[model samples]
Target: MKTAADIIIELIEKFDVHDAGSRRAHGKGEHHKARVELNEAGKDIFGEVENAVVRLSNAATNDKVPDWLVNIKGCSVRFNHPLRPIDIIGINFPYFPFDSAAETLDVLYRIHFYLEDKSAGRFMDIFRAGGLYRDLGKILKWMPKSTDMDHLYYTAHSYGGEHYKMKLDYHPGNDRIEIYAEKDEHLIDYHPGPAVHLGSILINPHSTGKEVKYFDVLNAPPGMPPNGNLPLLRHYVYKRSFLRRMEEKLLDGKDLRMLEEVWAEEKYFVLSKSQRIYDEIRELVKKGTDMSATRFRELLDEAYALKYEEKHLRNYLQHVWGHFKDEADESEKAHYTRLSEHPDPEAVNTFIHDLAIKYKEPYILRTTMVKTRGRS
Candidate 1:
């Protein structure tokens, strides 16, 4: 029996989406950092979170697709938990198309093949294999077009054992509803379970149009499922892809700077970049250059926190390498072949460059970078 990670790795390899540089899927995105003062409802679940990094994405496989082409859209809210942040991932649909993680992955695989082959027989085979055939069928025929992401109620589904499910409620008029301290025992995603109406997310009025790069789902709370499929699976596949590329870079023995270029896009790149800035600031402080010591101290604290997160992630991956190694080689081989023959090598670059330019409209991506002081 293959592990969930193994199946994910297979999906990562077989799909052309993972071949892209940073993100595996939904690479077309806009990022933001906001100050969040949790209301009583949110405070109950998350005690206090000062800052958060948010990313909104068009549910695109690659950068080529325009907004509204795909009915699905996603947003990830990563709470800045001082030590380690957790991302609350959500989509436009109130409930996921599939019933379980296992089923979700299985259906995704079948759907991909069906799209390529277009065999009606193979299409119904998915319905025959899964109990929720009607739901899956509905998903296949769901809105293939979506012009506005603002009105749709983006639904959260990262529930492991939590009693709450969040919805980014901007539905209709005056849709913002306050969440009370009560659990709504209702059926969602075709299952009857106790849930809480996690209040709507509103953009901070003060800060707008702030520059943000991208959001990582790796920071999700411990034991929470970061979806069984794409959008965030790039974290693992990214490391694998990085290592393979590094190996080939060594074998070719070409420009050593190419290694710098490659490593700059990986996970630790930001840390080193931060470290460089820290060093520059340290020198200024040593020179007795007049500056805000308070701001300097805050910078130091954030750097230390990020360093701790880096170390923690490295240790975790090292521990799990043995388990994930089973399918590592096969996945690498698949991506390597694509690297050799892929005609549009610039697709990834285009997607990345477009992030800063394409997502300017407030509806597509909001301007939010507020420093929340106290809870509402």
Candidate 2:
């Protein structure tokens, strides 16, 4: 039986072939480097790096990368492999800057600029602060679906002689599959969607003994394709069973209805979660509680865990907390009059409760839905 990895590989190969054909039809030949010149900032930042090449192509589709691929131009990067001795590191993006490849290049240039000045730590700080990922998510939420071939993007990084490859699979759904690999070892799989908290699965699927070991891709000698053909059948079986049991409980009428409502008003839930934290903080203020960042995070974390009851909620709660803090700070300056940053809690709660009558929308709405159903 073909594993998910095999399916992914086949999809990628199909995309490449289709893309090549499209380019030929358009009278455009593949260029070793993109035609658009990087700005001064891009040149300055990427100048120090050897063999960094960027390419813009419309071949990327919503199902394989960023869902906004239809509205935005997308690009991929190739550079020296950071952790491995491979000739190139592939950097893929499911989504890039909206409507402009130039904008995408600018963002990459900005990232490199920070990297050059302060190294990796500052680079990441700037990336997050700039709202790159958040903005991408917002755009993705509204963009039309792409009808093109699905493709995977590759980006590489290196630290302490360790090479890491990041892949974004734009499968058809609200969420994308994010894969992180170090050398030949698959490290992490991140799926972002309604059950986002249940999506982070770590695996070392190829170890012989009980001790899970990471496997390397087949790109060791250069010019060889990366290999993801690990013995994943057992791992898949275990995960399927685990998910089945979880879903049996979580997707029953009552629970499924609640989840459906949550998915429907996901935006409201995020806002309400933030507002509730602020309301609690206001009450705490009355009790002379310290409104320090530490305390704020603690309260938000507690509330999020209580409501979501999933392990991955913490990751999102942190982001929400950050937004809350910013909103609170603005409210302090009288820039906002509302006590809460979100809508009324009663209304939000009622909206969720009302969803109990509408549970037939879809039980499992995700790219992995078919795979899970097949196992059963």
Which candidate ranks first by TM-score, i.e. highest?
A: 1
Candidate number achieving the greatest lDDT relative to the actual structure = 1
TM-score of 1: 0.50
What TM-score does candidate 2 get on C-alpha atoms? Answer: 0.20
Model 2 lDDT on a 0 to 1 scale: 0.31
TM-scores of the models, in the order given:
0.50, 0.20
Candidate 2 on 127-215: residue-level lDDT in tens?
45335666655456635454342444443222122333444343324223322333422222222222111111122223222110111
Give the lowest summed-lDDT range of ten residues in model 1.
367-376
In candidate 1, position 119 carries an lDDT of: 93
RMSD of each: 17.6, 24.0
Off by over 4 Å in 1: 1-3, 12-19, 97-102, 136-145, 151-162, 170-376
